[model samples]
Target: MKTLYDVQQLLKKFGIYVYVGKRIWDIEVMALELDHLYKAKIISNKEFVSAKLVLTHEHKIEELKIKKLNNGGGL
Candidate 1:
C-alpha cells in the first residue's frame, strides 16, 4: 500500500504520472494532478495512450480512472 506521501513523492518526479490506487482514496489527488496537466496542456493524446498502456500493465484493479477510458472512447 502506498502512503499518500509515497504517492506524492512519485508524482513530484514528473509534472504528471499514471496513478494507481487501491481504491477511491486517491481519486481526488489523481484528479488534481490530471487537472494541472490539462490546464497546462501537457496531456497529449499520445501521452494518454502511453499512460493507458502503462496502467493496464501495472495495475489489476477495475475501479480506477484509467479503466474508465476503456469504455469505447479513444482517449
Candidate 2:
C-alpha cells in the first residue's frame, strides 16, 4: 500500500480500476474529473453512494477488526 501500484492492484481485485497519476497532486485532479462526470450525469448516484460507503465503512471496519484481533493476542 506504500505505492500507487499496490493500491491499484488491490482495487482491481475488487473490480475497480483507477487511473492514477504518477504524482500525488494528480489524485485531486482525478477526483475533480470524477465529480464533474457524476455531476454531468455520466455516473449514477447509486454508484457514487456505494463507492463512498465502501471506502468509508468497509475499509475502516476491516482495519479496526484487524487491529482488535492483533491487540487481543489470540483471544
Worst 10 residues of 2 by lDDT: 22-31
lDDT scores of the candidates, listed in order: 0.51, 0.50
Segments of candidate 1 deviating more than 4 angstroms: 1-22, 46-75
lDDT of 2 by residue, 1-75 (tens): 343344345445546555554333334433454465568876677654544444444445656776787897586
Per-residue lDDT of model 1, residues 1-75, tens digit only: 134444444456675454555444354545457456656776665554444343443344535455677775575
Worst 10 residues of 1 by lDDT: 51-60
Off by over 4 Å in 2: 1-41
Clashes of 2: 0
**lDDT score of residue 59 within candidate 2:** 47
